[model samples]
Target: MTYLPLVNGERTYLATWMDLYSRKVVGWQVGKTMEDELVILPLRRALQWRQPVTGLIIHSDRGGQYVSAELKELL
Candidate 1:
């Protein structure tokens, strides 16, 4: 997990992603907006270091960040 100070007086949000099997942190990013794009970037980076995340169990807080329509569609 990563905590990023909000810039420009925006709200602070944490983005977390974990790899179930390895119990290792697979992806994380800190930014002002809880947009799906932000989450996808780190996920993309993590995936770059491994195989397809088809069955990977990714868990995160029930924040707007993880509940975006685009992200859910992608998932």
Candidate 2:
């Protein structure tokens, strides 16, 4: 995840899910808030799009959104 400053001087958050094997960003989301949904939305989109087989692993920093109960449950 990264925070970017908009032209208005406000910051927005960008979350991305990359496929390590392909080295490509498979999913992403941008939002005004860095809430759990910010990360979850892109992850959900990746899951829905990729539908990878079992034993998939996801890695992320220890940010609040990444460690949130809601996101943990979803995973």
- Which candidate achieves the best lDDT against the true structure? 2
Q: After TM-score superposition, what is the CA distance of residue 62 in candidate 1 from its true location, in Å?
A: 6.5
| Model 2: residue 69 alpha-carbon error in angstroms | 1.4
Task: State the TM-score for model 1.
Answer: 0.58
Give Cα-based local distance difference scores for all models: 0.69, 0.92
Q: State how far residue 5 of model 1 sits from its true place (Å).
A: 6.4
Q: In model 1, what are the clashing residue pairs, if there are any? A: none
Model 1: per-residue lDDT, tens digit, 1-75? 345555666566566567777788777777766667778777777877766646766677766667887677756
Q: Write the per-residue lDDT of candidate 2 for residues 3-75, one digit (tens) a residue.
A: 9999999999899999999999989999998888999999899999999999999898888899999889978
The top-ranked prediction according to TM-score is 2
Model 2: which ten-residue window has the lowest total lDDT?
66-75
Clashes of each: 0, 0
TM-score of each candidate? 0.58, 0.93
